[model samples]
Target: MEQRKIPFVIRPRALGNAILVLVIGVLGLVMAHHPMLFSGFRRIQTDLRDTRLIHYLLEHGYLWVCGIPEHRTFWNPPIFYPVSNTAAYSDLLLSVGPVYWLWRAGGASPDLALAGWMISMSAVNYAAALVLFRKGLGFTWLPSASAGFLVAFGAPRVNQISHQQLLPCFYVLMTVFALARLFGGNPQRFWERGGLWLLAVLGGVLQFYSGFYLAWFLMLGIGFAVAAAILLPPCRTVFLEVVQRDLWVILTAGLVGVLLLLPLLNHYLPVARYLARRQYLPMYYAFNPHLWSWFHVGGNHWLWGWTAGREPFRTLGYPPEHLLGFGFITPLAGAAGLYFCRERPICRLAAAVTLSMWLATTFLPGKAIALVASGVAYYCLACLFREFNGPRERAFGLASVLALLVLVSFPNIYLQILTLSALMLCSLELVRTRGRPECQVVPGIALGLFCLKVFSLDVLLIGVCLVAPAAALIAYYWVGRRRDVGLGAVLLVVFFTAVTTILDSPNVYLGALAASSSALLVSAPRRLRPPAWLSVRALIVAMVLVVWFYDQDSLWLSFYNKIPGGIGIRAVGRIVLILLIPAALGLAALVQSLEQKQWTLAAWIVVLVCMLEQGVTTESFDAAANRATIAGVARQVTPGREAFYYRPWPNPGWNTYHLDAMWASLVTGVPTINGYSGYNPPGWDGFFAVDAQSTLDPRDVLAQWERAHGLPPERIQSIGLDRTCEGPQQTRHRP
Candidate 1:
C-alpha cells in the first residue's frame, strides 16, 4: 500500500506542548472565572450550587484524612445534622480525591484549592485537545493548539465553571487519543506501550468518578471508538493487540474505582437506587430533547445574548443544554475527516466518534428518537418478562439490572443501547440485503417508528426531523451540483424555516441528519462538475454553521427571574468564548487561503475582527458576584459542636442563599440541622414543617427533632439562640 502523505507535519515537543497548554489555562482564568490573579487568587469566590458544595465536600474529605473521625465517611456528612449519608444527596463522589489531598497537603484554603483545580483542569483540557489533534489526528502544533483552545475554553465549558465537577473533561479527549493510537495502525511494539495503556484507563477511571454525567458522555465516545475498532477490518488486528496489552490496566482501574466507591455504595445504595428509579423518567424528560432543543447553546453564556436577544429562551426556567457551539471549523474538519481520511483507520475512528458524539450530544432527531424508542422497548420488555423468576428475569430486566449495575459497576445504558442497536442494524442490513437498496426499508421502518413516537409526544420534532434530512440531502447534492445553487439555497431556507417556525427552536435532529446524509453523499456518483476546492470546504462549513446557529439560543438564559440571594454572573465570559469559534474559523480560512495563494489578507482581517469583538465583549465574574460571606457567622462556632439555625432561611426550592446555612457546617466542622441539597433525607419535610412554624415549646421541638433525625439530644445541639425556647440566649442574631 502506498503511504498517504499527511499535511502540516510539525512534530510537537513535550516542553512546547506544556507551555502552550499552560498559556491557554492562564488565559482561560484571566478571561473567565478568576480575573483576580493581580488582586489575589484566594479572594476569588464562585457561586453556591456545585462550586461551594464541591469545596465543602473537598474540605470534609481532607479533614477526614487528617484524623477527624466524624468526617471519615462522606455518608452522614456533618450536614443537615444527623442526616445519615446526606453526602449522597449530591454527587459528592470522590473523583476529585487527588485534588482534595493535594490541596490539603499544600495547606491551601478551600477557595484557593478550588481556584487552582479549575485553572489546572482548564490546562488539562487544552493539553488533551492538543493530544487528540496532534498525536491522534497528525495535525501540526499551531492548528492543534488553536483547536485545543477552542475545545477547552468554549462557551459551554466557560459557563460551567461554577459547576466545577463537570469542567475536567480532558479524560474524554485523552481516552479518544489513546484509542486512536491503539488502533490507528498495526500495533508496533504493543508490549512496550503498557504504561500508555495504564494512563489511558487511569484517565477513564478518574473521569468516571469526577461526574457521573460527564463519565457517561466520555463512555459514549469510547463506545464509538471500540465499535469502530472492532467493526473496521483494518483496525481489528491492532485492536486485539491493544486489548491484549491493556486488559490488566482496564481491570486495575475498575478495581480502584470500586474500592474508592465502596463506602458510598454500602451506605446509600438502596436509597439512591430507589430514588433514581422513581426520578429517572422525570429527570430524563426534564433534560431530554423533547422538552428542550438539543441544539440549545445555553442561557448563561454571553454570546447567547448577542446571537439571540435577552428574551426568555426557555418555556420554564429549565437547565440549559450542554453544547454551546462546536467552534466554526470543527464540523467542517469532521466532515473532511469523514470524506478525505478514510484510508487512515485512526482518522476514520476519530472522525466517526467525533461525528457520533456531536449527533448524540446535540440530541439529533434520529438519535433522540432511537434513544426514546430503545428506552420504551427496554421497559416494555422488562414489564413483559416481570413474571419470570430470579436470575432469568435479571437477564432481561434492563431497569432492574441497570439499578444493580450502578450499585456495583459503571455501566452506561445510553451508549450500550445506541452502539448495540447501530451495530445490529448495520449487520442485519448487510446480511439481509448484501448492500442492496432494498435493505433501506429496514432502517426506513425504524425511522418511521421513531417519527411516530416523537410525533405522538410532540409534532415539532417530527417536522424538524423530516426537514433536517431533506436539508442535508439538498446540501449534499448542491455540493456536487454548484450550477443549481439557487435551488439548493431555496430548499435549505424552506427546511430551516419550517423547522424553526414550527418548533420555535433550532434542533439537533436536523443538524445530525444533514451531516450524516452528507457523508453518504460523499460516495454518491458524480452528476455534475466540481466547484473550486475552497468552495466545497466553505459550503460544508456553511451547512454546519446553519446547524450550529440553530442551537445557539438554548445556550444562554433570559436571566429574568431572581430569588433571595440568587447569584447571576454576567454573560461576558461566555460571549468571549463564543467568539473563539469565529476566530478558529478565520484561522482555518487563513490556512486554506494561504494554500490557495489568494484571499490570505482577507482571512487575516476576519481573524482580527473576531479577536477585536472578543476583546470588547469578554467579561469576568465580579468578586461580589460569587461571594457568600458566611465566614463571620460560621467561625463563631467551635469544632465538633452541634449547630441549629433559628428558622434558617427557608430553602425556597434551590434558593442559593439557603446554601449559606450549610456553609457554616463546612467551615466550622459542626453538624448543622439547616442544610440543603436536591434529595433531602426522609422525614426532612416533617422536620422542616415543625421548624418553620415556630411555637415556643422546647420539649416538643426537641422531641420532634429527635423523631426526625432518629438521634439522641446529646448527638445534636441548638446553637446561637435556640428560638424554640424564648430567652436571652435567642438574642444573638447569628446569621
Candidate 2:
C-alpha cells in the first residue's frame, strides 16, 4: 500500500485566522465598493435617534427628557406625574447595556459607535461558541471555533433579525451551547468541577435577559438535552446531580443578574408602561377561528408585520420559500444530518425530537421558532453527527441517503442541483475521513453557505465550491504543507480587499481606517469641535459617547413603503449578504486553511447552504430607508417641553431603512413610545389587521390604560403624547 501524504498545509489555528480575514475582507470590499447602507438592505440600518437615547440613558441616569427640537434644548414637560414605561427602557437595555459605556469613553462617530456595538455582540457570541466546543462538544480548536461561526456567522438568516434582536439570539444560543456542551459530553469537565453549577447560573442569568425566546428554546433544548444526556454513559448522573445540587446556583444566576440589572432596567419602567399602553396589531397573523389555513406559515416566520385588510396568505403548507427551506440548497445534507440520528440511539432520539420540532415550528402557522428555538434546534442537530464517523463506514451510504432525500424534498432545479453537488462532496469527504466527526471542511463550507441568507443572494453561495476549493488548492501548491504561510498570504489579500472596499465605499465605512494600519485607526472620534446644529458641549459629549450596542417587522407597510430609495434595490439581496457572513467566514477559513496547507473537509456544506439562502427573502434597498429613519429621527428632536408621538413607531421601527426623528429620545435617555418594546397591549396585532393604521387617538386609549393601572392622565402627559399621531405637530414622527 502506498502511504500518500495529502499534505498538512493550513494547521487549525492559522486556518481559522486566515478564513476570518478572508470573510471580513470580502465584506469590507463590498462595503467599500458599493457603500450605500440602503443599497440592498436599507431597512436593516439603525435610527441614530434611538441610538442617541441609548447614550442618553447611560449619561443622564434615566432622567427622562425629550430633546424636542421645537424647544431647542432638553426640557421637562407640562405634565406632572411621570409615567414609568418599562418597554422603552427594556429596548434601551438591550441596545445600550453592552456597548453604552464603550461608546461614551471612546468618543466615537455614529457609524463607528454602531460598529463597535456590533463587534461587542460578535465577541460575546464568539466567547459563547468557545464555551460550547472547547467545553461541550469536546472538539478541538477547529470544531470549537466552528460553534461561534455557527452562532454568530453560521446561518445567513441572522442578518434579517433586527440588530437588537441579535442579542436575544446571542444570549439564548449561549445558554443552549452550554446545555449541549455541559450536558452533551465529558460532564466531569463542568459538573464535576462545578460545571453544572456554572451552567445553572449561566442559564438563569441568560434566561432573564433573553426573554420569551429563551423560554421557548429552553423547552425544546431541554428535551433535546435530555435525549443527548440519555445517550451519554454519564448523563443520568450528571443531569440528576447537577439539577438537584446546582439548581439554586443556576436560579441564583438569573435572579442575581436580573436583580443587579433591574435597578438600571427600572430606570426606564415608564417606557415599558408606555409600550403597554399602545397596541401592536399586525397584518400577517390572526387567530383563524374559521380556518387554520389562514395561519399557515413557513418555518422562518418568527417575525411580525402590520396586517392590512388582506386575509393571511391562504395556504396549508408553508409559504413557497419556507416550504422550500427544509429543502434549501442541499436537502440531502440536511437529510443526512437527520438520517444520521438513527446511527446512534441517543443521537436518533435527540435528532428526531429536535428536528421534528424544528420542522413543525418552521411549518407551523405561527411564530414558534422565530425567537431562538429554531437556531438552537439546528445546531443541536449538527451535534448529533456522531454517525458521520464511528463503526459505520456509511459516509457514501448516508451520502446516498441525503442525495435521494434532496431529490424528493426540493422542487427547484437550480437549488436541487447546487445542493446535491455540495452534499455529494460532503458525502464523499465523510467517506475519505472514515466519518471522523472532527473534520470540518464540508460542514464549514456548508456553514458558509448557510450564512449567506443573512444579507446576500443565494445564487452566490454556488460560488463557494467554485471559488474556495479552487483558491485553496492553488494556495496549497504554492505554499507547500505550511498552513501558516499559505493562510497568511490569503489573509493579507482578503484584508486588503476588505480594506480597499471600505475605502472605496465611503458611505459604508471609514475607508481611512481600513486603508491604514488597524493600530493607527481608533474607533473613537479624534476631534471634539461643535460643528453645526449641535452645541460644542453636545459635540464634545457626542464625540465622547461611551458606545453600547446592539426588531422585527410590524407593521411592515410603514417599513416597505417608506424606504429611502422608494423600493428599488432588492431587500432580499441585503438579507443574503448579511446571512452569508457565517458561510463566508467558514469558506474563507477553508481557503485560508488550504492556503496554509491544513486539512478540513466540510467547506462544501457552507457553500451549499449559502446557495439556498438567496431565494429565501425579497432583499432590497428598503434596509436603507429603515436605517435612515432610525438615524434621521434622532437628529430631528430638540429636547424641551414640546410633546411628541411615535405615531409610526414599531412598524418602521422594526425594519428601519432611514433613521427618523424618534431616535433622539432613546439615545439621549428621554422617554419614547412605540420604540422597540413588545409591551404593546394584547390586541395590538388585531388593531393593525383591521386597518393599515399608524395613528390612534391616544386620548381614546389613554384613559382606559391609566384607569387600568390606577394612574392619572398627568403621568402620561409628563412622559409625552397621549397617542402616537401621524400629524405635523407630532414631535417624534415615524412616517
Distance from true location, Cα of 374 in model 2, Å = 29
As a whole number from 0 to 100, the lDDT of residue 113 in candidate 2 is 51
- For each candidate in turn, the TM-score is 0.58, 0.45
Candidate 1 wrongly placed segments (more than 4 Å): 1-25, 42-45, 74-76, 92-97, 100-108, 228-268, 280-283, 289-304, 310-323, 326-347, 354-629, 635-646, 649-658, 685-705, 713-715, 718-735
Worst ten-residue run, lDDT, model 2? 542-551
Give candidate 1's whole-model lDDT. 0.48
Instruction: Tell me, by TM-score, which candidate is best.
Output: 1
Provide the lDDT at 424 for model 2: 31
- Return the top candidate by lDDT: 1
List model 2 lDDT by residue over 1-735, tens digit each: 999988757788887755753463334223221222324322323333333334333333222222333222222211111333333333334323446446645776444454455445555655655555455544345434443444443323332323243343455545555555444543554335355445544564555443333333444445555755554554466677656755665675556656755744554345434443342333112211112222222333222111111345343322321221212333333334335333433334444454433332222322322223222212212222323332222232233333433333332222222233333334334444543445745553443342232113433444343456756766767765445444333334333333343344443233222212221222123252122222222222211111100022222222333432212111211222222222222333332343244434454454334333322222223434444555555444445423333333223333221123334454543344333323333433322331244455444444454455465444333222324544323443222
